[model samples]
Target chain A: MIGIVGGLGPYGGLDITKKIIDETAARSDQEHLPLLLFSCPNLISDRTAYLLDKSNVNPGKAIAAILRQLEMAGATIAAIPSNTAHAEPIFSVVQDERARMGSTLKLLHIVYETVRFVDENYPDTTVGILSTAGEQICSLYREAFIRKGFVVVEPEGSQQEKVNNAIYDEDYGIKAQPVPIANKAREDLLLVMDDLKKKGAQVIILGCAELPLAIPERDYNGMIVIDPNRILARALVHSLAPDKLKPL
Target chain B: MIGIVGGLGPYGGLDITKKIIDETAARSDQEHLPLLLFSCPNLISDRTAYLLDKSNVNPGKAIAAILRQLEMAGATIAAIPSNTAHAEPIFSVVQDERARMGSTLKLLHIVYETVRFVDENYPDTTVGILSTAGEQICSLYREAFIRKGFVVVEPEGSQQEKVNNAIYDEDYGIKAQPVPIANKAREDLLLVMDDLKKKGAQVIILGCAELPLAIPERDYNGMIVIDPNRILARALVHSLAPDKLKPL
Candidate 1:
């Protein structure tokens, strides 16, 4: 069973789970999988909290609680849908919880799987990374993509601020009109994609899950955009059905 | 949290849970649903035993155990991925489980949901039903589809036996190749789909999940074959996100 630890604003964990289910179902020749969702939007602080470091919010405890509950309910394996949660201390808590429960719940690493997918599928392809400032500045996708032998491109400082402001602005939420912010984020992503395409990128990776919300299906100058969430979904499907995934 | 009443087959529970996760992850905007799978294929009886009425299978008790475990683990609703287990005493057992736990776990009816999907999506279209003898002879899809104002077609007596034989034959399992028995099953399904198309059927519903295994993407004389499992996946996606379901 899959367990998701969500509530990272702008990350979109629910979208990740949906992609995983769709890809797996479309590719499999067996029974459809069942799911349980636990959305804890209030459990942790926003991404900006880690940037400022004013008050340390330990997402580990909350993640542990969710995993323990999932294990108690008989989940074989669990996954934290958020990429940033793969940080040292946070990931440690998940391992600790599995230890405590005496269960073999494998916590899937979203970024690691995405990196593997890119390496295996689109080898030597330059990738553009569109994510929050917190992830960008922290170099979340940079090291991994670089190690995988792919060039990772990011937006300029000005564009990065614009993308961050749009995500954090409370007015956008109240107005329910994410168009302006989405447009800015999309523009920023397109710029990165264009630059990478010039550098021989056949595919652009939406390293940030929220970036897809901004640029749903916009074609970037004929370059194929790869949302890492979609990649992770494909990876999970392959893991579940090796025989079916062999051809794809 | 999602609670699965599994062991219908050794891997049925795991398979369904995987689909739910993959589908949820594929969504554009949503948090991943945490899943809890309770796989006890051992709790289920052999199909032969149930069909012959020589033994009894306590699906109610099995479902109850899963629900109670999920409720304790903080699940608000539960769904069983098994299609055939929804008959007779099992439904009552699920109700009893809810009552006993003082929990309001919504157990989803797979067949009912399939009927609702066909009625709403394929409105005046005739449907071809391909399922086990029990499901077909017992009028599982016929009753629901007819009530919703749709024509339902099934295979003839000899054709029905051929379909059943393909599924249970030991030799067929040893050799994964599609043999004559399996081909007959596929032909029967195609015949029903072809007849329904002549009678104005636009879609053919693969009522049995295993049928998809036997006939993977079999073209039914230009009629669109609808795998009920896929429909069920789409249904769950829509149920989780009502606003996301687009006009088909």
Candidate 2:
């Protein structure tokens, strides 16, 4: 059974779940894919706070506990839909959980999966990233892309502020509201995307799940905005259940 | 943590999950409700088949197994969203599981809860039911309402056929598509509602989860069409997390 470890900013969880439903060609209810979702929003500590502030709470250990919960329930293959949660610390904790609880749950790592998709599909060597400051400070995407032999570019100076404003704006941040598409946030997001394009970055990665709410599927002018959540979902369908991919 | 036992039909599972999200007054991800969903569409045998055909596979046994899976994973409160799954046999199996495993999972019985909702809300004594043939043969809603001292009215022979057609129509059925509103089914569903209204049913019930898909919320002319799924969801929120309802 496929287990979805979510509740990391609930909208992302809902977005990926809905995408899975839309992607599958289920004419009737019985025809759809079997899924198990463990939505522990409060259980896991905030990745941004933990990573940026060196908070006492270990998000990695919390994630491992949630994964162990899924394994106990009967999930052979599972996924934590948060890109920021797929860092090395979380992976290490997962290993620890596997050792302690004897868990065999194979996680679909969103960051690695998105990078793989980029490597295979896009020819660009330098990619722009739009993500939370936590991911930026953690060098989450930068180090991974560098290991894959690609140069990564992020918004510099005030341009970075605009991206952060669009993401963390109380009324307009992608996580602030039920629907993430606010006019003000969209306007600011467009500026950030344009600045990234001007900075010699060929492709942009919407590393934050909430980013897609402002910058739609084809918002960027000719530049590919890789939504890691969508990529993770596609990778999951392709790897775990390829036949479900036929509808999309 | 709340565990949702769904995928008896995929959309119902999604609908309830979405309702929980919508009902909550969560500004950010952390404040939202914690939910674990096991969408085991293939695992449970068809309810109608088991209820009518004397099928060897017991739906009660399947539901019990799913509930057991949830309890094993750390779900203290659990609910099965399927209306027809609350039959005597299913309850018996649930009792058996609880006895065998010493389960402390508090199950929200959808049928009983819905009946209680009707008892407390509407002053009118008569009600109409639009549901699947399985529910009709098993007298699921009718018996429950009768026990509550409410007069129950079902669609007539031809009218019942039309209701069933609107619900089970391969292409037009609510379960046939992700979004329940279908034009052809809606047209026929209106006729069924009008017939029930003419029969002096003070309130009409979308007894089957799929019925609400074909018949929109406001199609019952002057009468109230009770959606049991929404009622179940509301009951859950009210009982489990009253604080979350502040935003709504």
Measured against the true structure, the TM-scores of the candidates, in listed sequence, are 0.55, 0.84
Where is model 1 chain B poorest over a 10-residue stretch in terms of lDDT? B173-182
What would the DockQ be for model 1? Answer: 0.08
lDDT of 1 by residue, A1-248 (tens): 55555445323555655565455532222243434445554555444454457557756667777777665655555666666666655666657766776766666677788778778877887776666646543376778889877877666677556555555555542113454554544565566567666766676666555567766673578766767667666665565555433344
lDDT of 2 by residue, B82-131 (tens): 77777766667767867787777888887778788788888556888887
Q: Candidate 1 versus the native: TM-score?
A: 0.55
Q: Which stretches of candidate 2 lie above 4 Å from their native place? A: A24-34, A87-104, A125-128, A133-138, A146-162, A187-204, A215-220, A223-225, B26-28, B31-33, B87-104, B151-162, B179-181, B190-204, B213-225, B245-248
lDDT of each residue in B138-167, candidate 1, tens digit only: 477788889888876766677566556555
Assess each model's interface with DockQ, reporting 2 decimals per model: 0.08, 0.56
Q: Candidate 1 falls in which docking quality class?
A: incorrect
